[model samples]
Target: MPLPTADTPWPPVDTRVLTSLADWDAWYSAEPERLEQRYEGRGSLEQANRPAQYAGGLRGRLARWFWGQPTPAGEKSSKLHIPLAGDIARTSSGLLFSEPPALISEHQGTQDRLDAMAKSLHPTLLEAGEVCAALGGAYFRVVWDDEVSDRPWIDTVAADRAVPEFRYGRLTAVTFWTVLDSGDTNDRRLFRHLERHEKGRIFHGLYEGSLTALGAARPLADHPDTAPLAAMVDAEGGLDTGAPAHLTASYMPNVRPARAWRHIPSAAYWGQSDFQGIEGLMDALDEAWTSWMRDLQDGRSRIIVGDHLLQSLGPGKGVRWEDRRVYTGLNMLPRAGDPDPITSVQFAIRVKEHADTCAALTEQAARQAGYSASTFGEHGDGQAVTATEIKARERRSLATRARKALYADPALSDILAAQLAVEAGFRFGVTGLDLSVPPKVEFQDSVTEGLGELATTAELLRRAEAASTETLVRMQHPDWDDQQVTAEVAAILGESGRAVSDPTMTGAEGPGTHGSGPVE
Candidate 1:
């Protein structure tokens, strides 16, 4: 890395500055490093596609014969990545607000239009699902191109590169980083988008690096065309084609109407990765497995030879008893009058104790990950696991999912807000949505329930007509949107040639009663 240029101002960072900032470096690099190690297994980098190392003993040799001692990355990391984080992101991505965002004007048609626009943007906003799993949180930015169209579009920023700047306890700027493609696709130029709020005005600045070697860690500059101080950014930058951007632009005033939402409240930084809390457990489990393998390999066999015969054999091989002049296979010579001279000896090693200890260790590791001993193919104590015990373990896993939802739900709301704002400018298809009024983000819990519990929920939904239809529908199918529910209802009505009238509608009779109105 290079030294930071003292003359450069804030928000413009070169490689040295980026890697130097304590929090920034930790967030973007250090944390990912630790998480990746836990996921791929420690020392994976050093091992890099190599075979396993075994001790020089009977146990080591036996392990190679029985298990083949082929060490691969993540062999220790059974990726107990339960559906918690994934389910949270997957469920939250498809969530809907309790009600459509309200408009300032009381025009029902306009409100409906806005609702339609919101529905259209729902799937786009949901693109952050896998992103959230990769990074504990996901980001949403509203973008528009003056030359292309006036309508705003969504830009989902990866959490690893998205930096939100706060000034006086308020978010004043957001900077996103990307690697710009150069002549070589593998090599890249670093680019940054710094959207800042200054004097009640939004300023957008684009930064590009000059060196192809910048690859992933290019330097940044306020001015685009000037050759980036590679020496100041990275000591290695001079080695690459230190070619700066041919085109440059000054910080230009942004005229877009949307302001970036730093994070959704539910998604306001509350995600815990599968590997987060159990990293130490994973490390210990890996070590235990590795040690167990060594024990199995080195302790399974032994060979012995008589002292006088050993000299004649010279390390397990010598001339046969029949052929005395030259060395021969599977034969040893005995001295004259040598009584009770054992030629060679071999014995099988009983590894029951070592095997049992390994099994126990494997079980303990699995238990730490909230799984049964059998999950990792280790039978501890040789006890059969019951169905009830499995179900209870599954129930315990729900806690992780519940915690993820607490953060993901609010973050989804922030993303939805950005999406709603972007969709506000659509000239056709959607109207009546007010970008000023934030929509309510409602997370539908999709955790598996017992059959009895599911029955109870179904019965309750069937009996209550006024209860939240959306909630009921979500309870049944968490991934379904209002549009899907409508389609399902339409399909059902089409079958009977009759519609189920809404009890809340004006002049409606009873729930599930046939009505003249066609389902929307």
Candidate 2:
């Protein structure tokens, strides 16, 4: 959704539903401190003078593992082992795991209390509904492969060796939402909630192209283990009926792509995939997403839990037969990412300092784990390892070793600068084209000692059309702040030369100057 811009403004947010700008702003503003912390912290340093520091604290979720290993026999399942509190009071076969099942221990009292059981089970059913609701759809990756990946093509080979075809995919989110509307309650069921519109949406997403008739599809037993749990309830008992029905729903897929295409134009910008792959990647993005939607709608209802009354109680008439039990399980997802703002900034910034060669490899690892076109990311999204683990994953080579050996030398930053400059020019299509910059004859300032005025790297190249006397001197510094960024950008604009320096980094380079530099 294209949200409203701050200046354009919007109306007050609806407290009932997220309907206005203030609500959205409240949602978005919770994290602005991350940015402010980044800007305020850290000073100037040589971009190429130091070894890459380990991502100390602020790496968010890593991707997840998605082998895409095929579903088998047209029947797929993921196990969830739930923790339990106690044994049931009874046991039976083909049990419904019915709503309002008795929780009173046989150890306490085996007789009467049918009304109490109903009252107690009513809340238990309600609690189960609440727990399901708390599953909270926050993170799940599904996407189409980007057409521009260095690797070409992916075959979604099913367990039966069926090859589904497609190409483009980027990361996408998977979300769930429940629907509520008036529905006639089943005499057996005490509660109900379903609206025509919500059902239509679910049906449309699921049965769009399926050949099988919905009626003919077999409903899966809620849980096989629950069948043996029916012994606790009295065969003919229980009273009271008013209760709200509970159901689960999925909202929308949250596609946190490697980059925000609209906010970001170039690959060098962090928060997106660096310059990799081609333009056609967006094409394959749809199928993977819609297919999953289809699966969710068609298969979900069949597996949902619902209670069916085998027999009913006559008005004011009851007996001493117990009839309910519960034998199922549930699971929850843990949180991921760094808690502090400074750490996140550093993690992303460091990725850039390395020119992103390593981050790419990490992404490559994600892909191999089953994130092709139709998936957002695999691995890491849920994994929250410390900086130690991240740094351990960095790429190493003999050149890195030599570079490390000369860490203290001034020439070292120069060498690192050369390498980064080459990468920046090569990947971002930004060469050190010069503009009419002041001659680098002097470099004395609070920001930097003995640096001169700055100009676009492009302007410096046109010696005939512009200031030709502007000389460029190269100097390396580390830091990502106002003064440091200003100077680095000045250097970057004058980067066409072997050594470019401008201590007064006041001039923000037009366009391509990301100022993610020591001199920006």
Best model number under lDDT: 1
Candidate 1, residue 314: how far the Cα is off, in Å: 16
User: In terms of TM-score, which candidate is strongest?
Assistant: 1
Q: What TM-score does model 1 achieve against the real structure?
A: 0.45
Encode model 2's per-residue lDDT on 1-520: one tens digit a residue.
1111122111121222121112122112233232122212211222211121322332211111011111244574231111110000010000112223222222212112222324433433232222211111011111112335421111111001110111133111111211212133432211111111111011111110111111111111222322122332122211111111110111111112323232423211111111112111111122233334444454442221212212336667643323358723433233364222121111122323232432344344223221221122223466655433433442222222122222212211222222222222322333332211211111112122222223344345545553322222222232243565556555555554433343444356643344233321
- Candidate 2, 104: how far from true, in Å? 75
Indicate the worst ten consecutive residues by lDDT in candidate 1. Answer: 246-255
Stretches of candidate 1 off by over 4 Å are 1-136, 143-155, 167-172, 181-278, 295-396, 425-430, 449-520
Alpha-carbon lDDT, every model: 0.41, 0.23
What is candidate 1's lDDT per residue for 361-413, written digit by digit as tens? 54554454344444333433566455455455445334443444455444444
